[model samples]
Target: MSDKEIVEPLIPASGSQKIDSATKRGRIQMILLLLVCAAPVIASYFTFYVIKPAGGKANIGELVSPVQPFPSNVIEENLVGKWTLLVARPASECKVGDDACVTLLHVMRQLRTAMGKERTRVQLVWLVTDDSVIDPEIAKSYDKELAGFTFIRMPRDLAKKQRLMTWLNADNEQSAIHLLDPRGDRMMRFKTGEGHLDFKKMVKDLEKLLKWNPTGKVGD
Candidate 1:
């Protein structure tokens, strides 16, 4: 054989491998696209990183901060189009007598209605943290709340670690609705001092967080 032919005969033949190459190239393109799409979100947050909500209370759960997404912790999963939390705490120790249940309904209604377009995707999730068979009357109150929410019960130990509750002193606290973004992380606190969780000042900050995870797009 000629020197070139002899060398070629010893070497392995190469296949087209077009599909493999295309898949790698496509993956790179997808990654780049995600980065491009997220650029605006980064810029907005960075620009307003120091800016707070219009009023007071601008911190974004700095006290509780974010949980950094450990698998051991529980996250509010998206249900239907709504994202909700089955708070392992109760709304109040007060009996659900008179029009209290109805009033609670109104509060929940307002909260949901306030979300407007997001209403369809967010809800109140009242979770009883006990194995006791709830009586029919108490169950009725739960059902009433469910009308405005996605209510259920879970073991206190398991549900209490949902992260948000850790921020709120739930030792004998009330069940407060949590506001969650499309992603499953607990990015804000809704059940704060009086009325609702204080976010008027941090609304823009939250708006940024909702759009982008503080962690990098791929790793953060």
Candidate 2:
């Protein structure tokens, strides 16, 4: 053997470095993807949170504090398939002839119109707080308002949680009108108060959320 040709064998690569590099790349990619997916939702929230609409124009709707993230299982089991929720805070049943009943019905009509062709996806739910049984005739009449209004009788726990939500006008803006998305998520809140609510704006935003997160739940 020639002394000049003598050479030691080269050590093989450990592959550990390559694996770690690959892992780091995967994590970075995942983070980037998450940020990209969340951009629209984050932007919408910023529009509502950071931007203060100039003047006393009165945005109408109020912002809730400590933005909540609902669990998918719970929302799916109970809230999905439910679109519009009209929570009546009065301690008694809402009969058709009463002032409260009239106001609620009208509000629902406006909500339906605001949704336009997507009206079918909109649903109405009445949370009866009292022990009194809902008059069958009154419940039957609710069917006429739109194709998807439903009346659900829930206990007080439901009301208390909602009460804890952020206030839009007064501390007690009871009997809320919630616009639930197709995935049964509560994104838009409405009121029958004196000032006007921008239902069209809300509907437009919802349409965007639906498109952006087509397979995932809103606020996910």
Best lDDT among the predictions, by candidate number: 2
| Model 1, residue pairs in steric clash | 53-201, 82-121, 90-175, 91-174, 91-175, 215-220, 216-220
RMSD per model, one decimal: 9.2, 6.6
Candidate 2 contains a number of clashing pairs equal to 1
The TM-score values for the models, in the order shown, are 0.46, 0.58
Per-candidate local distance difference test: 0.45, 0.52
How do the residues 1-220 of candidate 1 rate in per-residue lDDT, one tens digit apiece?
Answer: 7666645356443465777788899999999999886553444344345443334434544322332221223435333233443344444432356353444444555554554444444456655444555445545654533445545554345455554445433333344444443344343344544544443433444444433433322210
Give lDDT: candidate 2, residue 158.
61
Can you tell me which runs of candidate 2 are displaced by over 4 Å? 1-16, 29-59, 63-78, 81-86, 90-93, 144-147, 155-174, 194-220
Worst-scoring 10-residue span by lDDT in model 2: 67-76
Task: List, residue by residue over 1-220, the lDDT tens digit for candidate 2.
Answer: 7879969899876799889989999999999999986554465456554553433233444443433323343211355543445555432547656766656655566655565555555556665555777766666756635434555543346654354333322345555565444444445566666554455654554444333333332221
Error of 1 at 50 (Å): 7.6
